[model samples]
Target: MASPALPGREPGAGPRVEDLVQEVKRLRAEVEQLRVESAQLQRAVASHAVVDQAIGVLVMTAKINPEDGFMVLREISQHTNTKLSLIAEQIIKHAQDAALPETILAELHAALARRR
Candidate 1:
């Protein structure tokens, strides 16, 4: 037997019941995809803020440009086999604390150079 027509659904509404249901589902999926993209954008913005502040610290204290600052941090991570996030956090914390010991900074540079 044929299924009964759903309420509020016109026969010529451009889609059958199954197609309408599928279209609704597709729209819902698109909305979810947009939500995920927005969330990712928010995260990227926050990460950018943190990294930017860290780079500013490097520029002010280490006398480097933004590009060089990021390059230096990446080089540090590669040389020490540490994650960039940790090093970025350290840079941010150092800026906040304003008491990053010079010895540690020196050691960090040396470590980045694979000298020790």
Candidate 2:
């Protein structure tokens, strides 16, 4: 079959300007998607660092290992219907300032006690 012809161009000449424009648009969209994914991955990395610090605090305070510390945080987060990262942040702040919500403290104590 004959290829579609552009105004002043032969049927099988190199790619048309429209094709180049479409490819550029597609690349731009892909780049935007990659940027969003990169930002999300960065945030995840930061959250992971915070959680690790919080786990260190728990390990020291409860005389438990890192694995047990993570379990304690997970238990409190699950019981409180909170995000693990948020729970970890609160724990880190409490370590620094000695201030924490009573509900969270109670759940934390219960979780630690169960582990013992």
Candidate 3:
């Protein structure tokens, strides 16, 4: 038996129901992609903030210039096999406690001394 047409929709007028369903599916996929992109952007922004703060800490605590401070972070990130943002986050957290690990403290001092 044929299904009755919806009210205000003729049997063969406008888009078929399947077409509308496909369009809704396509829109949902697009929305999901946008959500994932938004999350990535948010993380990038947050990581940038942490890295900036860490650079400031290096400048003040290590007495290194901003350029050298960034270099120090990059060097540590490379040496430690860690992401730059993760290294920056660790530095900021340790700085907050005023108790950085001995090895990291030594490295920061060495980097600063080298810059002199």
Top candidate (lDDT)? 2
**Candidate 1 runs further than 4 Å off:** 1-14, 80-83, 98-107, 111-116
Candidate 1 structure, TM-score to reference: 0.69
lDDT scores in order:
0.72, 0.94, 0.84
Compute the lDDT for candidate 3: 0.84
Q: What does the lDDT come to for candidate 2?
A: 0.94
Ranking by TM-score: 2, 3, 1
Cα lDDT tens digits for candidate 2, 1-116: 88678879788787878999999999999999999999999999999998999999999988999999999999999999999999999999998987889999999999999998
Clashes, model 3: 0
lDDT of 2 at 23: 99
By how many angstroms RMSD does model 3 differ from the true structure? 2.4
Candidate 1 lDDT: 0.72
Residue 35, model 3: lDDT of 100
What's the number of clashes in each of the models?
Answer: 0, 0, 0
Q: Relative to the unseen true structure, what is the C-alpha lDDT of residue 101 in candidate 2, on a scale of 0 to 100?
A: 92
TM-score for all models, in order of appearance = 0.69, 0.87, 0.79
Tens digit of lDDT per residue, candidate 3, span 24-76? 99999999999999999999999999999999988898788889989998877
Better of 1 and 3 by TM-score: 3
Which structure among the candidates has the greatest TM-score? 2
